[model samples]
Target: MTTHQLTEAQKKQWEEDGYLVIPSFFDKQETKEMLDEAKRLCDEFDVDGHPMTTFKTAADGEHVGDEYFLESGDKIRYFLEPTSLSPATPDTPSRLLVPPSQSINKIGHALAILNPVFRKHTLESDKIRSVAKSLGAQESPRVLQSMIICKQPRIGGVVPCHNDSTFLYTDPPSAIGAWVALEECTPENGCLSFLPGSHKLSRTATRFVRAPGGGTTFIDVPGVEPNEEKWDDMDGWREAPCSPGTLVLIHGSVMHRSPPNPSDKTRIIYTFHMIEGGKGVKYDEKNWLQPTEAMPFPVLF
Candidate 1:
C-alpha cells in the first residue's frame, strides 16, 4: 500500500478552509479501474423494475419514501434525474423510464462493500488512513456510505448548498466526505463549490429521515436552527475544479453545492463519507438511511 502523507501546509489548509483538494490522489491505472467498474455497474443494474428515486435538493424538494430509498441502501440501484419525470400526486404513480442517454443521476451506499476494486481503494488504501490521521481522528474512521455521482450532460439536477452531517448525523457530527473525480470536473460540467470556513460557523440544523409512519421528512436537530445567512452569502464561496484522480475532502459541517450540467460533457465521480468510530461518538438511529441486512457499511482502519 502506498501511503500518501499530507504536508503541514495541507493540514493547516484543511483546518482553515474546511476542505482540501489533493491533485491526482489516484494514479491513471487506479482511476481507470474505478471508471470501468462504475460503467459495468451502470450497464448491469436493471432500471426497469427499480424504484425511480431522483436526486433531490434541500429547498423545494420532494421527500422520498423509506421503502423506495432505504430498500436500496446497501444494494446497487439507479436513481433518475428529477427532470426526467413529470410531477404526480400521491394517489397516482409517476415513475417513468429513464432514457439510456440520461438515465442515471447516481448509485449509492454499497459500491465499496460489494465491488472488490472499490473496497480495496476505500478500505485497504493507506491514503484514506493518512487522511483520517491528519484530521486528528482518535479512532479509526468508519466508512458510512459510498456512491458514484453522474452529472449527465444538459439535464443533470442541481444539488443545493448543504452539509454532509445533515444526511449522515453523528452525535458530535464527525462525517467527512472523500470525493474522487473520475473525469475532469469543470465549472461548466457542475464542479463542486464550497463556502470557505463554513464548517466552523454552522451546526447541523435538520436531518433527512423517514417519519415513524411512512414517507421521508426533515426533522430538526435539538437546539439548532437552520442558518440561512451562511448559505446566503456567496462572497466567500470558491469553486474547486479538479482533474481526473483528484480527491476533494469535505468537512461534515461545511456548506457546499454543485450546479446543474448545462455543458455537453458529463462529470463522473466516486465518493464516500467516513465518521469517527470511537466509543463516545454515537451514530444517530433515527437517520433515514441505514445499513441493509445483507451488507452493512464496513469499518476502515
Candidate 2:
C-alpha cells in the first residue's frame, strides 16, 4: 500500500468485517485536544431558557424528534442524557436530575463545520484527507454531520442497533462513519459492539427520515430484513473496546450498537459521517437533517 492509502490488510478488514478499528489513529496530542475541547464545550454551555431535552434512541421505538432536534442539522446543539432526568411530579414536568454539564449526552450535527477546533482537526487535517481518499467509498465524498458523544458516567444511554446509512441517507445509499475515541472505551463504559459481517448479509438498513405529517421517524428501506437467527445469537457479535486515540471506520450498512454505561467513567467519542455528493447521486430534500445555505455539504478530496 502507498503511504497515502490504507494498508491491504485494512482494506481486507473493511471488506470482511465492514468496519476497521485502527489503534492510535488520532495520536495522543490530537486526542487530548479533542477531549479537552469537548469538556470545555460541555462546561461552558449555558442552559438558560433552553429546553433540557434528553436525547433518546428508538431502542424503544421512540426518540426526541422535536423542532430543536430537526433544526440542528447545521448547528451544534446539546442533548441531555436519558438517564439523567429527575422524575416528573403532577405540577412539574421532568427535568435534569444533576447539573446540566454532567447531564449532556452530545453536542452534534455540525461540529466539524461550525467548531473551529474540530474543523481544524477533522476536515483540514492531512491525515483525515489521506484516510478519506484511501477508503474511496463514494465517488465524491461529502462530510455531512459530526458530533462529540459524551457517554456520561452511569447515566450514559444506549444506542440501538442501526446503520450510518439509516441516519445519513443518499441514493445508492452512501454513508461511512469516521469515529474516534477521545477517552478509553471499555465493556463497563459502553464500548461499541458490532454484528460482524452483517453488512453483507443484511439487506437494506432502516432509514430515519422526515415524516410526511411532521417531525422524524424511521422507515424500512425496501429490502429483505436481517435474518432473525443471526440477530438473536450473541455469540457472533464483536465487542470493540479501545484506548483514547483509536479510530473506527464503519461501513454504511454495518449493524452496530452500544449498551448503556454502568461504570462511573465517561466514554467520549467524536464522529462524522460522509456520503456521496457526486453529480448523479441524490440527496433527498425531505431528509430530517437538511443542509442549510450557510452550512451546505462540502466535498472532500
- TM-score: which candidate is best? 2
Query: Candidate 1's residue-wise lDDT over 87-138, tens digit each?
Result: 7798987655466536678887677877798888888788877766766743
The deviation in Å at residue 223 for candidate 1 is 2.2
**Model 1: residues >4 Å from true position, as ranges?**
86-98, 228-230, 292-294
How many clashes in candidate 1? 0
User: Any residue pairs clashing in model 1, and if so which?
Assistant: none
Residue 34 of model 1 has an lDDT of: 92
TM-score of each: 0.92, 0.94
How good is model 2 by TM-score?
0.94
Who wins the lDDT comparison? 2
